[model samples]
Each structure stands twice: as C-alpha cells, then as structure tokens.
Target: MLKVDGLTKKFGELVAVNSLNFEVKEGQIYGIAGPNGAGKSTVYNLITGNYRYEGRIEFDGQDITGLPPYRIAKKGIARTFQVPEIFPSLNVQETIRVGSRFGARGGLDKKHSDEVLNFVGLEEERLQHAGLLNLLGKKKLMVGAALATKPKILMLDEPMAGSNAGEIADLMDLIKKINQQLGITVIIIEHFMKVLTELTETLLIIESGRMICCDRPEIVTSDPRVIESYLGDSYAEDK
Candidate 1:
C-alpha cells in the first residue's frame, strides 16, 4: 500500500502539484486522470523522488519523502515514462537484463527476465535491437523492463498513447494480466477514459493540481465536475 498526504511540488513561481491526498490499496488497479498541466505527472515524479516536494509520501507504512529515485525503486516501486526510453544499441533481451541488474535485488534474474519478455510478447524479438521496435513493441518493452524490476507497484504513464483500437484492446488485456495474474498493484496515469474505466477499480481525478474526486471508475467518470472539466457530456451518457 501507498499513501500520499499534502503532496505539493513547486517549480519557481509555479506550483505543479498542489496539496493532494490519495491512497493505493495493495493488489488493486488504481487510476489517475486529468487534463494537461493538472500535475498528474508531477505527482508521479514526487512519488519516485525525482524532485524535492513538500508533504509526505509513505510506501508500505514507511515515510519515503526524500529518498532518491534509486532508493524508491528499491522499495518495490517502478514506473514507466510517457515515452518509451530504450537504448538504441541494446538488444531487447539485454535491455531487460539491464533492468534486472539494476533492480531492487541488483542481479541478473534470468527467470524473471525471460518471463517478462514472454509476458510482454517479445519473446521472439528478444535478440532484436531495441531501437527497431514499433510503437506498441516499444511500449511493451518499456513495461517489460519495469516488470523485470520485480516491483510490488507498477506506475504506467500514458501507456495507451499512440495506439489504435485493436492495440488498445491488446494492451487492456495485458494490463489486466499484469494486475490479476502477476498480482502486482497498478497505478496508471492515462488520458483514455475507456482504458481507465475498464482497467482500474479506483479512479482519482485531479484538476489544477488538486484532487477533484476519487472513487470507483464508473462513479468518478459520471460525476458532473469530471464530465465538465475532462470527460465532456458524451461520457456521462455512455454509462
């Protein structure tokens, strides 16, 4: 489990993230959504210790406010960026191996690495250069690298970006498997309403860097404020 209270991040005169409070229960798929500049990614940066912030962040009951990014990753938290970051020269297998090597345990976990490769559907492409992958393949590789870290909680930022409908369906199934089959707690920050509603149990909506509402996906999506600020009138009728 993770808890955040009064989490605020300021850059110069701008407050990217306001006083925010939320919790992600163990073994649950959590969702975060808001329009651009709502500080959604800032929250992720704070959680991962990318920048110094005001307030408290607790993971599994310990205060992790100022820990470095590596320290946070060591504490069972791993995340993917909005854009897939891959080493151009490294092969797919080698890239994931690097992840396992830098993971909490700090070793080459061949079994888990192979499992991640297969889980991400890149088994056949394991020997291919990571830079050559298509968009979807690159995203899968990104997720695989995070999985190789053996994280208790996986935070995905815009995992559905730049995908077709079929690709979205494929990824939804993959995300479900990551939560259900792997039993890993998930915190996904996404723009796609359908992905958030269908994949997550608890949805937290934010606006102007603060919490707007946090509840079941259906309820949060149907809320009038969410419809007004983000979802629009059409989403309410879809319910």
Candidate 2:
C-alpha cells in the first residue's frame, strides 16, 4: 500500500535517515524496530512530510515525497505520536470531533465520531475532560482521534509505552482488531520484540538509518546479523 525507496534525510552533517527502503502491504501490520536515535521516528517524519527528503515515497501508487504534512494526512495517512497528544481542555468526544472535522474531506460526522470513541473503549469517558484521564485512557483517546481521521493506513509510534501487562494486552488486541476487522493497514514502531513477533507480519530492522534486515518477523528475528547488531547475543541464545 505504501512504498519508500532510497529515502534519505540529513540535518547538517548528521544523517538521520539514510537510503531507507521498505514497503507496507495493505491490511498488514508492519513493524519497525531500532535502538534510540536510529532514525526510526525520522523515517516517519519524512514519510509524513515533516522534512524535505532525498528520495521517493509512494502511497497507493502516487508520489508523496514533498507534500506538506496536512496534505499527506489528507491523502489517507494518519499517525499517532510516541507521546499521547490531545487537547487538554476538550472533552473526549470534542477532541475526536476535531480530528474528524480536520481529517474528513466532507466535514465531521457526529455519529462516526461517537462510534470511534466507543470503538476505542472511551464511551463512558466521552464527556470527561481529556487531561483528567490516566495514561492508558489518554493513549486510547489518541488512537481514537487518529481513527476518527478515517485513514487507510495508520502509523503508530510506541503505542505500548508506559502500559502494564494487562494494558499492553488490551492495546494489542485493539491494534489487531483495527487491522483484521477494520481492514486498515498498520505501521508500528516499537521496542518490544515479543510484541513485534506476535503482531507484525513483516519486521524492518534498522541502525544508523540503514536497513539491517527486512523479512517475516520469525525470519528477521532469527537472522544472525540482526541478532548480533540489534537483538544482541543474549536474545539470540534465548532463541
């Protein structure tokens, strides 16, 4: 559904993302993993039009490399940040409505917004202020707002961060349902290997903005170079 070829981004002398190439199939959960400052988030920034990149990015067969961020969002791509972001003053329902209004080409749909709130398991909290919610609630709200945009592909950055085991399970189930039931393509950037193995079909590993490997989770995780460079010798032994 989305293809990136030779995508490179540099800030002065520092090459944040270098010649990164990958593809995300429709209705698939594609995972990206790398250590901190490995240009993982920078790739997303380049794809979403936050930076001027030296490469090609195509979605549904059209080039979107130099488009502005809002234009990219309008082109059926929506993303959630590593940190939960929402309007602190707005109620849950109102926050989602803002997304719907901005993202929907035809304007906001109140019924659809309400359904999105319920879909993210925030129905009862719809009228509550967004800042009053706990971490998990805020995260769910962030996902719900992104869903409200009606994106064909959803890119999530560290969606499981700061969650307990049960909350992680809940979010994982929700992500699976969003992919399997809703039929939206998913691109997730996460640190947890188990989560990637369980949820993603294709896993892309990168370091210093270069591809280490790209294959099925099982194959990529078992790769000797991948184990040595990213997963470490200890994780390799456990395998």
Candidate 3:
C-alpha cells in the first residue's frame, strides 16, 4: 500500500535518515525498530510530509514526497506521536468530535464520533475532562482521535512506551482489533522485540538511518549483523 525508495533526510551535517527503502503491504502489520536517534521517527516525519526529503514516497501509486502534512493526512494516512497528544481542556467526546470534523474525509459524523469513543474503551469517560485521565486513558484517547480520521493506514510511534505489562497487553489487543477487525493496515515503531514479533508479520530493522534487515521478525532477530548493530548478542543468546 505504501512504498519508499532511496529515502534520505539530512539536517545540516547529520544525516538523520539515509537511503532507507521499504514497503508496507495493505492490511498488514509492519514494525520498525532501532536504537534511540536511529532516525526511526524521522522516517515517519518524511512520509507524513513534515520534512523535505530526497526520495520517493508512493501511497496507492501516487507520489507524496513533497506534499504538505495536511494533504498527506487527507490521503488515508494517519499517525499518532510517541507521546500522547490530547486536548487537556476538552472532554473525551469533544476532543474526538474535533477529529471527526477535521480529520474525517467527508467531515463530522456525530454518530461515528460516539462509536469511536466506545471503540477506544472510553465510553464512560466521554464527558470527563481529558486532563483528568491517567496515562493509559490518554493513550487510548490519542488512538481514538487517530481512528476518527478514518485512515486506511495507521502509523503508531511507540504506542506502548510508558505502559505497564497489563496496559501493553490491552494496547496490543486494541492494535490487533484495529488491524484484524477494522481491516486497517498498521505500521508500528517500537522498542519491545516481543511485541514486534508477536504483532507484526514483517519487521524492518535500521540503524544510523540505514536498513539493516527487512524480513520476518524471527529471521531478522537472528541475523548476525542485526544482533551486532541493534538487537545485541544478549537478544541472540536469549533465543
């Protein structure tokens, strides 16, 4: 559904993302992993048109390399940041309504907004202020807002970053529902290897903005170079 070739993003003398190439198939859950500052988020920035990149990005067969972020979002691509982004003052339902109005293709749908709130498991908190929610609640709200956009492909950046084991499991289940039940393609960037192996069909490993390996999760984790550069010898030994 999405293709990237020779993707390079440079900031002054530092090359954040260098010649990265990968593809995300429709209705598939793809995962990306690397150490911190490996340009993982930068790739998302480029694909979402937040940066001027020196490469080609095609979604559904059309080039979207230089398009504005809003334009890209309008084209069935939605993303959630590493940190939870929510309106502190707005109630859960109101915040979701805002997304429905602005993010939805055909504009606001009140019925859909209510359904999304319920989908994210925030139905009881619909009238509660967003700021009053806990970490997991806030994260759910963020994902719900993204879903309100009605995207064909959803990109999640560290969705389980600050969650406990139980919360992680909950988020994982939600992700599966989003992909399996809702039929939306997913691209996730996470540090947790087990999460990637269990949820993603294909995993792409990168370091210093270059592709290390792109293959099945089990295969990529076993790659010698991948272990040396990112997964480390401990991960290899664990297996």
Per-prediction TM-score: 0.97, 0.98, 0.98
Per-residue lDDT of candidate 1, residues 124-145 (tens digit): 9999999999999999999999
Clashes of each: 0, 0, 0
Error of 2 at 183 (Å): 0.6
Q: Highest lDDT: give the candidate number.
A: 3
Q: How close is candidate 2 to the true structure, as a TM-score?
A: 0.98
Better of 1 and 3 by lDDT: 3
CA lDDT, every model vs. true structure: 0.92, 0.93, 0.93
Instruction: Write out the backbone clash pairs for model 3.
Output: none
Residue by residue across 1-239, what tens digits does model 2's lDDT show? 89999999999999989998899999899999988889999998988999898999999989888999988988889999999998999999999999898787677989989999989999999899999999999999999988898899999999999998999999999999999888999999999899999999999999999999999999999999888888899998887
Error of 1 at 39 (Å): 0.6
